[model samples]
Target: MGFFDLKAECAICNKQVGLHRFQIANKEWVCPECFKKCGFTAMTPIKTMTASQVQAALQEKEKSAEALKTFVATKKSDHF
Candidate 1:
């Protein structure tokens, strides 16, 4: 017996579809009929953040941390 049994219904046509014929995304089982009706000729592809974008995000996070640290240090010194 298979460990996983895949079964789903087309969102558009309401026809039963085997798991192998379609894909699940965002908790939705997208059948070919629904995909075609939605005008999606190809499967949605995954997107990866670019290295520069990632680096920029990290830099912004680090800047926020530094600002927080400076604020905390000033507040502590003032209390003492």
Candidate 2:
């Protein structure tokens, strides 16, 4: 069997990747052309956070949001 003998489908375009090779991301097959078009050289997972970690992140975001809101309100009042 030759190198091109292998057959697989591209993950991005869902097309056949026979003669032309494809890229693999997280065990997913992707065509070479589609890989370039999709602009993904590497794929990383963002699914390692636990429930409590997620909640902590959300709380931190809310605190920053509140701080920003307070700063904006003070600035708007000073301008008016």
Candidate 3:
């Protein structure tokens, strides 16, 4: 009793892809076969980074901000 819907149609071929066997293309549901024939590849992975990379970048920015804060705090007044 674990049925699912599969009535979604492919955008390029205008064919039913059965929901579980299709990919998204330009906001339209497309069958995998047609997706390949259109020379499209998923860019989600390449556009995003891993958690560790994001963490390291955030830490580096924090360190730079702390350095700037200390530098400004200990500065000797040139006027007055």
State TM-scores per candidate. Answer: 0.34, 0.35, 0.37
Per-model CA lDDT versus the true structure: 0.47, 0.51, 0.51
Query: On a 0 to 100 scale, what is the lDDT of residue 16 in model 2?
Result: 72
By TM-score, the best candidate is 3
Reference-based lDDT, residue 34, model 3: 55
Candidate 1: segments with Cα more than 4 A from true spot: 1-4, 43-80
The residue-by-residue lDDT of candidate 2 on 1-36, one tens digit each, is: 234567776554567778565433344455566544
Clashing pairs in 1: none
Summing lDDT over every window of 10 consecutive residues in candidate 1, give the lowest-scoring window. 46-55
lDDT of 3 at 30: 50
Which pairs clash inside model 3?
A: 6-18
* Residue 76 lDDT in candidate 1: 39
How far residue 27's Cα lies from its native spot in candidate 3, in Å, is 5.2
Q: Write the per-residue lDDT of candidate 1 for residues 3-37, one digit (tens) a residue.
A: 14566654334577776444433333445554543
lDDT for model 3, please. 0.51
Kindly list the per-residue Cα lDDT of model 3 for residues 4-72, writing each as its tens digit: 554766554577777554433234455666545434367433124433443354466668777988884
